[model samples]
Target: MFVYLWVLFGLFALHEDIVLRQHGIRFVFHGFALVNALVLAKVMLVAEDLKLGHRFQARPLIYQIVLEAFILATLFIAVHILEHTIGGLIAGETLAASVPSIGGGGMQGLFCVALILFVALIPFFGFRHISRELGPGRIKAMLFGRRESAAQAKPPV
Candidate 1:
C-alpha cells in the first residue's frame, strides 16, 4: 500500500515539475521527490492508524468524506511546509521566506495543495473503508480479478 501511495506521489511530483519547468521555474524533483513520497507515505500510515473518518460512520457519507479529506490534506500540507522550511534552512534563508516559496504562492499554494490532496484521497480512502468491511482479499479479487489466498489477505474488519 505504501509503495502504491509513493508511486502516486511520484507522478504528482512529476506533474508539478513539468508545470514548474514550463513556467521557467528553477525547481526540479531531484532528491525532494523521494523525500516527499516517503514523508507522505508515513503521514498516510499514521492517518490510517488513527482511523479518523471511520470513527464517525454514524454521520452522513459526505461528513465522513470531508473529515477524511481534511485529515489527509492537513497531513500532506504539514509535510510540505516542513519540507519547505528545511529547504529554507539549507539555503540560508528565513523559514518564513522558504515556507511559502511556491512562487510566493503563500496561502494560495497551501489551499490548492490541500484541495488537490483531498480530491485525490477520496477514492483511495472512501473505498478503503468499504474494502475493510468486505475484506481486503475480496476487494482485491473484485478489483484485479485475481483470487488472493488467505495468507495474502488482510484480516477482515
Candidate 2:
C-alpha cells in the first residue's frame, strides 16, 4: 500500500506539472506531501492524545481534510495526463511499436495498465474521504482558495 501510494504521488506530481499546468498554485509540492503525511500524523497524534503513546500534536480535522482535497485535485490532473498518454500510445500502432518487447505479454502493456489503475484509485478514495467529512465547498475552497481569487482565476471548466 505504501509503495502504491508513492507511485501515485509521483504520477500525481508529473500530471500536475505536465498535464494540469497548475504552476500558479502555491506550495503544490507541500500540499501534496502534507496530505498523506498529515493523515498518518493525525492518526499518531490522536493515538497519543489519548495517552496511547509518545507526545504528538494532532492537526485540526479541517486542515487535514482540506489538504486531502487539494492533493486529490492535483492527483486527478496527473491521472488525466497518464490516461491520455497511455491511450495514445496503445491506440497508435507506430507508437506502440516503439515500446520494447519483453517476454510473453510484454511489460509495457502491464506497466501502462497498472499506472492507469493506480492513478484512478487515489482520487476515488480521496474524493470519498473529503466528501464524507469536509463537504465539497470546503474541498473547493482548499483547492482554489478564497472566493474572490477563485472567481477571478477560474479556469474554464
Candidate 3:
C-alpha cells in the first residue's frame, strides 16, 4: 500500500508542479506527497484489518477486488476531506471555509479523483487476492524462483 500510494501521490506532485509552473509559481511538495502516502498507508492497513469490503467475498474474485478498491478509494476521499478540514481549522478558518475543494475543486473533480483512485487500487487488490489464493510466500517463489531447465520440463512417460 505504501508503494502504491507513493507512486500515486508522486504523480499528483508532478502534476501540481506542472500546473504551478504554468502560472509562474515555484512550488515543490514531494515531501507532502510522501507524508500523505504514509498516512494513507496506515489508514489502508487499519481498513484492511476491519475488512472494509468483505461483502463480496462469496462472489467472484473480481467482484471482491473491485469492491475493495472502490471502498478504499472512498475511504481515501473521506480522509482527504477530513485532513484538509482539520488543517483549515488549525489555520483559524471557519468550518465552511475549512472544507477544501477535493479533486480539482468541485463535484466533478471529486468524481474524477475517486475514479482514478478506484482504478489505481484495482491492481493492488487483484494481486493481493491472488497472493492469498496462492498461499503465503507461494506467489513470491513462483515469480522469483528459477525456471526449470528444458530437460527438467519434460513429463515422464
Give the number of the best model, judged by TM-score: 3
26-72: candidate 1 lDDT, tens digit per residue: 68665665776677878878877877667778866667767887888
lDDT of 2 by residue, 45-146 (tens): 453365431122265444444444344444433444455567668787455553434212456644564455544555644564555578667877776775
Q: Is candidate 1 or candidate 2 better by lDDT?
A: 1
Candidate 2, poorest ten consecutive residues by summed lDDT: 48-57
Which one wins by TM-score: 1 or 3?
3
Error of 1 at 110 (Å): 2.2
lDDT of 2: 0.49
Question: Compared to the true structure, candidate 2 yields what TM-score?
Answer: 0.26
**Candidate 2 residue runs with Cα over 4 Å from true position:** 1-57, 93-157
Q: How much is 62 displaced in model 1, in angstroms?
A: 4.8
* Candidate 3 residue runs with Cα over 4 Å from true position: 22-24, 149-157
TM-score of each prediction: 0.72, 0.26, 0.89
lDDT of each: 0.75, 0.49, 0.91
lDDT of 3: 0.91
